[model samples]
Every structure is written in structure tokens, then in C-alpha cells.
Target: MLDSPLSARLEASERILVAGAGGGFDVYAGLPLALALRDQGKEVHLANLSFSRLESLDIDAWLDEDVAVIGPDTASRDWYFPERALARWLDAQGLPATVYAFPKVGVRPLRAAYARLIGRLGVDTIVLVDGGTDILMRGDEAGLGTPVEDMASLAAVHGLDLREKIVACLGFGVDAYHGVNHVQVLENLAALERDGAYLGAFSLSRATKPGALYLDAVAHARSEMPDYPSIVNGSIAAAVRGEFGDVRFTARTRGSELFINPLMALYFAVDLDGLARRSLYLERIEDTVLARQVAAVIAAYRDEIRPRPPKAFPH
Candidate 1:
């Protein structure tokens, strides 16, 4: 039952890689979909552009120069290793706990890492899951939020040859704190729709099995890393559980007011190639070998363009 365009597109794929585009807890955004795919008897794998200190990992953990296989017992000194946290959670659930992680490198090395993973995993489809909508920012927005990791993942996957490439983003308005304008996100989606890139959106309800599992996974992660739980996933999980306005799931968002609405539970997906084509500065970062180089390129590009003024949603 291909209920949505995203599912329909993925229907033919046997091996799929759902990767975290913006690193950190971004891969958690793909959990529901990955679980649902597994339920449908498809082989789904998890990976992330890791924000952890990969340099501390043992040499045997390295699957490639920039890529490593994170497991439940992967030794790490970093307290905020989301990949290892997720691996532990998966292991507890008696699921495959091996998560492929890439160091925070630039597009060149990142792309090479992705290529190695795709080839080794025999992945026919790649879904880049972003925890927030910041990945949709096409370079000229008034605020780009955190575009470095997102754009790097986009550019890296854009260079890959695969049967299908998709981008799925959860946590719609959560990027407000980072200065992302939801109006601009909508405007960008409209543009993608015009380009035939928008795959439409869907909601994750707590009533469903995948949603229930997602909540459990998030709760486990929170318990494991109590000091540094993901604010983004916490907000989304709150929304999924029918919480509203300033829902306080974690102390991380203490000083800030959160608009925890049902919309945060919605997943907005698009064609990866279409998104890559839409990013005005994606090409400039293609040859980058270091994360800082990608940041510098984006900074220089932002300096040249007169950004579109941020607009409020006039409802």
C-alpha cells in the first residue's frame, strides 16, 4: 500500500539508507519511516553525518577514512554522541544496532564516505533526513539557520548515483530559535513544487506502531543522555504526543519559549536532486575537503546576495 508519493517512490527499493543530514540527533527524525519500512519487509539501514568526536574512536571502528560503524558499545569520551546513544537504544530493542557514521568533513570526503557506504550496503535508495526545515533554505533567505552540515550532506548525496534520493524534514518551526523563517520554508517548498520536487508531507501519530516505537526510542535516548537530550527531537516527540505551546520536555529549551504544535510532527519530503539543484551555493562547496571550508563558502556567498526579507505568516 503505497499511501504517499514518498512511499510510492521508495516502493521498489529493496535496500534503503536513511541518513541524518544535519548530524547530531537528526537521524532520529528518520526512525519512524525506517521502522515502517522494516515492517513492510524492506531492509533499512541508518547512518549519520556525526557531530561526535570521531577522532577518539578506535581504528577498527573505521569502515572508511571518514566513515565508521557505530555500535551499542562503541567507546567514546564524548557525552553527546547521538550515534552511540541511538545504537544503544536499537540494541535494547533487539534490532540491528550498527549505525554508520561519517566525520564532520566537507563535501569531497563526505561524498567519498557516502559512496563507500552505498556500495557496501548495496543501497538502492537514499533518504537524507533533516531534524529541522533548515535544509530547505536555498542560500538567499534572510536567515539560513545552520546550513553548513545540511548543505554538505545535500551536496554529498547529490553527487551519488542511486535509484532514488529523497530529503525528509521534521520539526517545521523549531528552527525559529536559529533564525529560520517558516514562511521562507513554505516559499521554498512552493518553489520545489514548481520544480516537481515536493513529495508532499505526512504526519506521525503516537497511535501508530512506528510512532510508538519512535517515542520509546526518544525516551531511551533522553534517559541515556539526560544532560544533553536533543531539543529538536524532544519538541517533535512532544508534538506527536499531543502536547502544545511551550511544552517543556527538556531543560535545554528552558529559557526559550517553544511553540509545540501538531505541525511539528509532520514530515516534509522532497526529491534530493531537486533540492540540490535549488540550493544556489551548493556548487561552491562541492570541492570542499574540510567542514570549515564549506562554512567559509556559505559565508562568502551570503555576503554577495541581498537576502530576501523575513516575512511573518500572515494568517
Candidate 2:
């Protein structure tokens, strides 16, 4: 189970946040994993910034069925229920958590409100998926009357110290149709970090050859420093390839060809909910006992699986 090398740091976080850009459908991908963690008795939360495409989907139907409406036009209903229902479901599962989907509010109040809530809740770890807001914030370097650094700045502003906290990133190949590819996304992320020590990430459903190359790279790198947080790759490939005991990494189809973004997205959400609630950690070095149990099941098929390369389609 330790073979897949998911981040060990994540197991130690209690407060978490799953964040991503608005256009991609990764959030929908994350829902089922979040639900599963609830079944395993972990607290989790889901957060999508306001104006995210995720907010425009059919919240009512998704809550009822946990389905994703990949395109904005497929189904229409009040999108509020999914967020509310997710919260209600968490409570029902004996996990105390909330889901916050932010809207495209004017810069001023949105920053203030975000900081206030984080402060009130005392968040710990933040799971960022294909999000550039952290880097964008750094490029702008304008403070929101709250000390903002990087994406981690959000937590810092709310008085959440991340020096000892964990941040999990299931960063992977983005939808070929939505945004930059996986490599480009990581290239940008590398530019944003000063020390690579705290970052942990994993890949999902990339083209087969590249996925294998990436898996090999991350695995070799992480095994060397077993103490550093694990950066997982290939798990998405494993999940999709059915190497991990029929468990799914994605619950819904992504706008991309592979339709594998949701599993990674929801996994981040479940982890964040646990982090935000302080249920993901155990002794702060080892991952929270609750999270490790799940990762154990998830990490098993590292060798048994391989992703099928995406097929070329006629233009």
C-alpha cells in the first residue's frame, strides 16, 4: 500500500480545502471519493470558488444522484442544493463539515469574506487542484489587509499556520479541451514554490506513455526522501486501469477525453473536509489514521496497472 507513495503529510492534517479553477469539471470528479470517506467515518468539506462552472451545474440532481453535468448546458436547476445537500449529507454521516462554492464576487468583499471564514473555522490543510489563484495572488502581490503569500496565503490570512500543515495536490493532466496540459500546469507550479518540500501531488489519466514517465519520475523522487510528503502519480491511471481493486478515482466524466478527472477531484475534497475538521491527522508526522486506512486501499495497485493511451480521433 505504501508503494504508490501518496503524501504522508496529508494523513496528518485536520482542516482541509479542495480548490480548483472554475472552468474544469474536476469537482464533480471528486464527489464520490468524498462520499466514500464519509462512509469510512471521516469529516470532509468541498469548496469551489464562486463563478466556477461547477456552480452552474444542476445542484439538485447532483445531490440526489451524485452525477456531473459536464457541459454547462446539459441540465439546469438551482445549483445551490448540491452544496447544501453535501453539507447535510456530511452531518447525516456523523461528520461535521460544510461545502462552500464561491461566486464571482467583486475582489474586495470576497477576499474579506474568505479570510473571515477560514479564521472562524481554523482550517489546516488545503488541497489545491489545477488552481493558479495562488500564483496569481503572488504576481499581483497586493495584500487584502490580510497577509497573503501564495495559495497557502489564504490559510495564513485566516490565522491558519501552514508551516506544520499539509497540502495535497492531485494535480494532473487537465482536460485537453479546458486548460493547459498537466506538464504545463506543473511547470507553473514549480515556479511558484520556493521550497519543494511541502508540496504533494498526483497525476491522473494522462496519455499512457507520459503517464508512465511521470509515474516513474515521481515515484523515484519520493522514495528517496521517504520523510518528505509523497507526490503520487499513476493512481488515476491505476484507478481507471482497474488495478486498484475496482475502486474508482473519479465518480463522473470530465470534459476531457479520459473522463477521469472527477475521482481525483473528489478525493481532494474528502481529504480537505477531513483536514478542515482536524480529522485527517493522527500524530502530525504519520498521516491521520483515518486517511491512511483509505490510502492503503488506494495505493495497492501501483504495479498491476497501466493506463491505456488515448486514442487518436479524426478531426
Candidate 3:
């Protein structure tokens, strides 16, 4: 029996795809949920919008024109391949090591690539995961905080036909470094709730098996790429361990002060299509073929609207 609406929505789903909506270490944000679901005997697959240079990969790695299959042993010219690093870590744990990677493209081609993958995998449910809450930002926010990749993924997946489409975000306040306002994030979530789209929140604890494995995976990834450790996941792992107030897990956040509170460990979910429809400019980037084009459209949209001034949380 599923207690939360998020779990209830996914209760009937047997084959689930947990894909990173934002590129880079965003897929790591979905690891705990994927691991927990897999432990329940559900078939879960992992994928990411890769920041790596997919063109440098061999032809055999290509699952489609835009999708690449990255395994533990997949060769790559770039040293910073998050997908490959994650695959290697999963392999070490005796789990599935193949992670599907989609090149950073605009919505049209990205949606087509997703369609092909969905058909091939026989996926009935898709949970698009974002490392931070910035994916919840609407166009009228004071700052969008690097929304190109996240929006593209949302727009693409929202168009797909599936039994369930969900959006989940971890590392709540981490996007402040990227100029996001947490007050707005909360306000947007309130709006989503009013629309019957918001799913209740839940926390991950180090006491759980999935949480322990997630900590191990993040530590392993940090050791693999010390120079480029994921600040978001590191903060999240810290929160799960009951840490608080400016916890520094890596040198990447050495200069910036962090707030590693319990909120950072919580996962907030919403209906994907509801979130997409609330985005004022999603339609503007629908025809974009390149990532830069989506950025340009968002920039233009921002210029045309007077952004709501950011507010601080009232105690």
C-alpha cells in the first residue's frame, strides 16, 4: 500500500525510467529512489542528459542518433563523464552498469530521442529528476539559474505518452549559488499544490540501505573526480547524515557558504505535465534544435517580463 500520492501514482508501474532532467550529476539525485524501487523488484533504468562530448564516443556506443549507451568500460576522450563514472560505481556494487545518455539538444530532437528510448525499453513510467529545485522555476522568477537543460528535458518528457510522468527534485536550496530564490521555489510549489499537481515531500536517511548506498556512490564519484565533485549531491549526502550549517564536503564549495539543512535531504515531486503547462515560455522553445537557441529564447522572455522581486522566508 502506497502512502503518498507520488508512490500511489507509481504503484501500478512495473517498468520505470528515472532520467536526469538536468545534465551532469543530476541523475545522481534520482539514485536513492531508483535503488529503493529496484529493491522492491521493479525494473528501473537510469539515463541522463549528458554534458560529456557524446560525439567523441565510438559508433557502437550510439543507441540512437542522440542516445548513447554508457557502460563501466565505455571508452571516452573526455575525463569528466558523470554517466560513465556512475556506471562504474553501479558495476562495483554488482548492479546494472549500463546508463543511457542523451546528448544536450533542444526539445524537438530530444523528444524524438526520448520516444525511441521509451518504445525500446517498454517504459510505462518516467520520473524526471533534477538535482536542485530550480527546475520548478517559472519564467517570471527573478532568476532562472541555468534552466536550459532542465526545461528541455521537462518539455520533452511532458510530451511523451506514458502511464505516469513525474518530476522529482532533491537538494532544495542548492540552486542559490545559481541565483535561484528559495522563497520563489516554495511559492511555486504552493501554486502546484493548488493545481493538484504537487506530491508530498519525503526525506532520505543514512539509516536506510538506499541512503547508505547513495552516500557510498557519492563518495566514490568524488574520489573518481576530486577536481569536479558534485556540490549538490555532496550537500544532500551531508544533510542525510544529519549535518547542518555550512557543511563543506568538497573544495568546490570552499569559497561559498552552504546551508546543509534537513530540507536539502527532502525530495519534492509534482506532475510533469502540470509543471510544463505552468512554464510560461516552454512553448517558445518547442522548436529549438540547439541548446543555445533555448537559452536565447529564455533570455528574450526574461527581457519581456518584469520579474517578481525575490522575497526572504518569513520566520
Candidate 4:
């Protein structure tokens, strides 16, 4: 007696883990979902495929051979520690306070690290959250839009033995900078629905508490690191503020005008098991131990496969 597939899977889950599939600010995309789910009284943990230098962290910070516990107090000479930055913001808001960070590694080590984290947290549900829709690409897209880290998270978590694993992408129309085609993105989602992997899509409203908090978090992150503000969140924030096409926000998009449309505010979800089953090349990098190795494997597979023609929005 489940109202929806996502609810049915999440029904028995007591502790949930929301992780960023891609490195960098991708974890910020999970803020709204994490906040909304927290409102339902579920215990949630946040983690990320971090672009930070985990090797530089002190031994005490290491939770496992591959994972590190990042907090607001965590210090680094490196300017790009998204995990610590997020932890700081969470602390300022008196939220969960600690964010777990996994190094940008391949499927083998990444999977091992994820298994350890799952064991430590006793997590019943693992949600792979992506900042953009690129994670939906099924290996035959004309462009995969920086698939390395996203696919690594996908393959790594796919190898885990878990009751419920889901993928929820928050920001849409943001990966176009990396040449992702949204028409093909829709086509892949339709195919996943046929395979029973598509979990349905929802939009984030700025009026909601979670959405308002998310907007605040994104704004705070931008203020903390103005030079490297997230284009994805900027677009999503603009859409939430009721902006329309071709609106300008950051200097990065000065030459290339952005389409600040509503789609950027939506979250498209799918079943991890079904999505893994549909992958044409995930198996190729299963044994990879380095990020470069994973990239090489995907490149070779794309070279061998006949890619689907890129489609454009007909409207």
C-alpha cells in the first residue's frame, strides 16, 4: 500500500544518506531534499565526492582508509574545500554539523569507502544526489557532460549491498555548459520509466522552508567563496526567484547568456539498481582504482558504441 515507488522504498528506511554524485559543489544540490526529508523526521547524513585534497587531512579526520569526516573546524591551506565549507555553513545554521567526504577515486576504492561509511552509519537508504541531470546519461549520449565523478559515484554505490538506493538530481539545465542535451536527457528518463527505474520528478519551491533554507545556504556559500560560486545553484536560485530566460548573474556567464528558466528548480529521481542495470559501460570500469582509469574506460566504451544523435528542444 505505497503511494509512490520512492515512498515505498523509503518506507522502512530509518537512517538515510544523501551524497553528492559529482565532486565540488554538487553536494549543495542535496540541501533541499535533505532539509525536506529531515522535516519528515528522518535522520539524514550528507557526503560528497570531494575535489579537496583528502591526503592533506590529519589522521584523526580519517574515518576509514578512504573517507574523511569534515566539520566547520576542519582547516586546509587549499582554497577549494567544498566539504569543509558546507560543514561550516551547516554549523552556522545549527544543522547536522558534520559532512563526510570521499576522495575523488575510482569505483574500487570508492565502493570500499562507501561500504565502510554505510556500515558505520547503519544507513538503510542511500540517495545519490547530483547537481545536474547529466547523471541520467546512459552511456550513449552525444555528450556525457563530465561523467567521470558522477559515474564513479554511480558505479561505486551500485556495488553496495543495500535495501534501498536512489538517485535524485536537483538542478536541471545546468550541464549545458558541458554540452549536455536536455532532449536526450528526457529520452533517457522515458526509457528508465519503461524499465521501472524512473521514480518521478518534483520541483523545489522557494516558498517552502527547505527551499528557502537551500537558497540561503547557496547564497552564503557564494559569499564565502565569491570567486568560485556554483553556476548550477545560481541558475536554480534565479529560477526560484521567478526569473525567465537569458538572465545574468555571474561573470562566468557574461559572454554566454544563461536561460534562467524554471526547469533548473526541479528534481528528477530514479532507482539506482534499475539505472545501473541500464548502464552500457558501468561494468567496464568496475575494477578501476584511479579516476583516470575510469575516464579511460568510459572513453574507450564511447568510442566503440554508436552514440545516439543529439536532440534539441523542439519548442
Worst 10 residues of 4 by lDDT: 1-10
Pairs with backbone N, CA or C atoms under 3 Å apart (clashes), candidate 3: none
- The TM-score measured for candidate 1 stands at 0.98
Candidate 1 residue-pair clash tally: 0
Q: What is the C-alpha lDDT profile of model 1 across 1-315, one tens digit per residue? A: 437788889989999999999989999999999999999999999999998999999999998878899999999888889899899999998999999999999999999999999888899999999999999999999899899999999999999999999999999999999999899999999999999999999999999999999999999899989998999999999999999998888888879999999999999999999999988999999999999999999999999999999999899
Q: Which ten residues in a row have the lowest lDDT in candidate 3?
A: 247-256
Per-model TM-score, in order, reads: 0.98, 0.41, 0.98, 0.97
Q: Of 2 and 4, which scores higher on TM-score?
A: 4
Instruction: Tell me the whole-model lDDT of each prediction, alpha carbons only.
Output: 0.94, 0.35, 0.94, 0.89
Write the residue-wise lDDT of candidate 4 on 1-315 in tens digits.
436677777878889999999999989999888887787889999999999888888899999889899999987777888788789899998897889999999999999999999999999899999999999988888899999999999999998988899999977888888989889999989999999899988779989998898889888888878888888888888888889999877787878868888888988999998888888999989999999999999999988989888887889
Per-residue CA lDDT of model 2 for 242-307, tens digit only, reads 353333333333232343333432122112222223311112212212323323422332233442
Off by over 4 Å in 1: none
- The parts of candidate 4 lying over 4 Å away from their true place are 1-3
| Separate clash counts for every candidate | 0, 20, 0, 0
